[model samples]
Target: MRILSLILALSFFLSACETVKGVGRDVESAGEAMDDAIND
Candidate 1:
């Protein structure tokens, strides 16, 4: 039972990390686009 709980927690943590990483990538892309528009 404890092992199952640990596995579930780990899975949630990993998924959360991936979600945050995706958001970070989106923000970076937006910033780059804005910078390019300004330079152009």
Candidate 2:
């Protein structure tokens, strides 16, 4: 039972990390696009 709880927690942590990474990428892309528009 303890092992199953640990596994579930680990899975959630890893998925949260991935979600944050994806958000970071999206923000970066938006920044780049804005910069391009400003430069143009």
Q: Write the per-residue lDDT of candidate 1 for residues 1-40, one digit (tens) a residue.
A: 9999999999999999999999999999999999999999
Candidate 2 per-residue lDDT over residues 1-40, each given as its tens digit = 9999999999999999999999999999999999999999
> lDDT of all the models against the reference?
1.00, 1.00
Per-residue error for 7 in candidate 1, Å, reads 0.2
Model 1 TM-score relative to the real fold: 0.95
Q: What is the alpha-carbon lDDT of model 2 when measured against the actual structure?
A: 1.00
- The estimated TM-scores of all candidates read 0.95, 0.96
In angstroms, how far off is 29's CA in candidate 2? 0.1
Regions of candidate 1 where Cα sits further than 4 Å from its true position = none
TM-score attained by model 2: 0.96
lDDT score, candidate 1, position 13: 100
Looking at model 1, residue 37 earns an lDDT score of: 100
